[model samples]
Target chain A: MTPFSHRKADTVAALGEERLISAIRRWLGDVSPPAPLGIGDDCAILPASKKAQAITVDPVIYRRHFDDSIPPCAVGAKLLKRNLSDLAAMGAKPRAAVVALTLDPRTRLDWLEKFYRGLAACARTYNLAIVGGDVAQADKILAASLTLIGEASGSRMLTRAGARSGDWIYVTGPLGGSLLGKHHRFTPRLSEGAWLAAHPEVRAMMDLSDGLAKDLHALTPSNAEPALDPALIPISPAARKLARDSKRTPLAHALGDGEDFELLFAVRKNSNRASFEKTWLRHFRQPLYCIGNFVSIGKRPAGSIDLNAHRGYEHLR
Target chain B: MTPFSHRKADTVAALGEERLISAIRRWLGDVSPPAPLGIGDDCAILPASKKAQAITVDPVIYRRHFDDSIPPCAVGAKLLKRNLSDLAAMGAKPRAAVVALTLDPRTRLDWLEKFYRGLAACARTYNLAIVGGDVAQADKILAASLTLIGEASGSRMLTRAGARSGDWIYVTGPLGGSLLGKHHRFTPRLSEGAWLAAHPEVRAMMDLSDGLAKDLHALTPSNAEPALDPALIPISPAARKLARDSKRTPLAHALGDGEDFELLFAVRKNSNRASFEKTWLRHFRQPLYCIGNFVSIGKRPAGSIDLNAHRGYEHLR
Candidate 1:
């Protein structure tokens, strides 16, 4: 088989920038709530009175996180977005972030501008400002990492824990090989996370950067299993292309191909009835779906997907 | 005459750790901060209010930052220490830090532990916590970067722009090389920075990761000349060792060598007199030397010790 599966995973050139960003911006357009301390500046500006804070860090490698074929601006923007997405996973608001950039001379200044453009594009859109960071030229590869410092607001700050049996499991945005094209351009669901945290129904929340199966397992409480409906997943065209071969590799891609940057949340069945309302629909331009539900305290989901979870690559495994 | 300077710059290994950390801890130890969100945990936990917040990010590379022969653990600790020192530079109390580690598998975990041990050693003594970070495997050389997050208490924050002509230029700990042998293990002056921030006299501030010459050039405001006394610059054993061979080369090491992690600040004359107090018998572990004074606007000091003004080995140059 050809190493690259164009059918299963598409890119920005294919998705159309308007469609991709429109789909994303619709869900996360507002600014963070005013806080005395936050990750938005050089040092957190949060008020002196809050009890606790939330912080998360993420490192973006060149080929591992994204390909250099993409512009530098996108790389810069997405690096921050990746970390911001982690804070969103914890149901925390974006405060401020620190960036460490290891630059490669192979990347021209124009590329760096584009990189910052992508970064500024995200930060400006979300009202998150670039504060302070280190910059240097590298002989090897270009790398950027962001560490987001945030505050929990009043939400106890959700985590992989706090999920319940029978809770409806859902995902924000479409899924599949975001890597095909979306890897360098995916928008973090920080705004959606803030909204969800404000609502108090986002029992367990996380960002699915590492694919559905592995991420779901991470979110699943240690003692219980997660029951999912393969048919209900919000598969993107990328994943659909993967499955076209009928070898089941595509199905695994949908469940395993990582770096999607989508938010996966578990909600109590009784309280989630209003999730499909007009008010809620405003939070996302892409269709949202209930892929599965949590099961009783029992065995974990034994295997991944039907296409042979083992057939493909497994990182942690 | 080598293409590059035969002299090594003032680096961490040369400064010796005991002298460095002791000076810093004594200054800022009054602040005992805690972070379940530690400097190593993932991210720093700072205060949060009901508003938007801020944080800063910086990255450092190894050959570009220090010589490659240095131990891996020291490399690890230095990465985090540099970031923490940035927080101190801002006069912001450190909350925590997040790291991004990228290197080949050739990078030993044992070295990584020593790095963490150095980081932990510095973090504990500095009262800063390790929060969280990211790690990656790469093919080329090693790269470790950190995004340190700190809180500004309120709106009282320090910036480089705050420096003015006639502000007594001050530095925490000695100038010159600390990286010769112990560069990796040297601590950033996080504590002294916080204390100086609390004090009214200290004005603009920054850490001396880069040598005094290059860093001072950055600190010299308004195009004024930096006239310095070569005799005033504090010389370390590493610097002395480097100087012993070729007076010009190692002096360049003391001048251009980066990764000292010492605090460089501009304080008003007489407002904080104790900062410069040093007797012949008493060793000011982290001493602020009056190497040079800020000249009037428009004049560059002809004799100022130019750490970077002198040509040296290019880390990333």
Candidate 2:
């Protein structure tokens, strides 16, 4: 038999996930795009005739991100929602998406149909079309990757770069312990993002998928450091319940447990915070919390803050 | 172990590829996007303020699409090239792309770097950017899903729907036997597609990915049937060689083998064929062949053409 006959035995576990990602970034980092976009942001902004378009791609894999117990429709919905959240972070209005499904040969056709229907149901709410995509076969695990395209004026688009030292950091909802199930069903803050994009006070924005501790680094400028108050962190009900059953603090889960899929944004400190809060309450029934403020890195203990930031959810143990 | 723990064992082969794709189209088919685009085309056209943006996504899996013998860079290049071919089919100028990679945990970091470097080299030639993408871990196979975005005016874009009974069928280059290796290195006919799109005589267009026999159905309108001349089929040197070694005829390989990544398009029979041919010769040194014409389904023996059209590469046996 040829090498391909048993190629399924070869796996990617050897090099580890983080290293593989870094290698990819290093390889593609030099090709300067038409737009000034890079690999690290939630979405890459493209140059357009009228408004900048934001594009992002993400894949959800079987066993790793989900399992058989989760309905196939929920799987489809989560993948789409994750990409939508990326666009939301950039304050772009998602217009369309393409999904590529690479499935293990044993997947059921009925399950696949349910998945697409679920994705369609979610997309209908936003009026985003599922335009085109490709299908292929994988050997063992099934995976689906969604690429979302959205548009926004350049000035209105948000990124992790513009936050100043005195900017106040806020979150659209409570965070932590999303793995309990909320991670698959949570709605993306599209409307809130659209409103924030138009507001002059919003400085920097990103989705809190990898937990506040890790994603915070993406939003903070090199000259500044995030000074989040542990006591001020609003823990989710799931996190609170999980904390009650375990020795880990709810704050730890709030700070480190990833997959919250909420909006973490910074606002200009001098902006009308009170009015903004009132307006936010009037617009969304969801609770918003002021978590912390950005501070100059030189003013804080370097090693301590660095250690705290490095305490990402992945390394909770 | 939980169901999630053993989920990697589940495969998609049981459902088959075509059925899975059908399920996807059924579920997402109802979304009335802001644009008039739908799912069955090579690329989904999005309405932009000044132009239409074409988007497509494709995934290349280890072993299935390629093996370790093909260099990592070639693997990366092939994945991007495939997506580029889809854009080319629409006569769109590819502007940017987002790549999502799900790697088998054992994949080498160096190999991943080589793949990206390869993709960057190809992107540089077209002035396309590797804007953004995501990375995740898979249990077995290393797969890369690329979402490419391109632009063209609405009138300039091409689709498979415009072929009329009198339109002549043409292919930019010879086809077939890509499994011998051309599938990994063939360049997409972007320039040829662009030229055809600009020509007022071209009636319909699409790329030949899944053998000319199967893809022809996608290009032929419901009111018409394709009547291809087997003798006129331009067999690639690779296909000719494979046919000589095997029992199959070169024409069979040309019609049934896939992944040519060449443009298969239609031109109006009454158009200036001579001038268009001359212009094509001037722009491209590659050979162009006119092998067939569309006929009304009632004008031909239904069973005779059905057998020929059903000679899809996947069921070549």
Candidate 2: stretches off by over 4 Å? A1-49, A153-155, A301-310, A315-317, B1-49, B153-155, B298-310, B315-317
| lDDT scores of the candidates, listed in order | 0.59, 0.70
Give DockQ per model, in order: 0.30, 0.16
lDDT of 1 at B151: 62
- CA lDDT for candidate 1: 0.59
Listed per candidate, the RMSD to the true structure in angstroms reads 10.4, 12.1
Where model 1 places Cα greater than 4 Å from the true spot, the runs are: A1-52, A152-156, A272-279, A282-287, A297-313, B1-62, B66-68, B152-157, B247-254, B270-288, B297-315
Top lDDT hit: 2
State the local distance difference test value for candidate 2: 0.70
Per residue, candidate 1 scores C-alpha lDDT tens digits across B244-287 of: 76666555666666667777777675564653444311543544
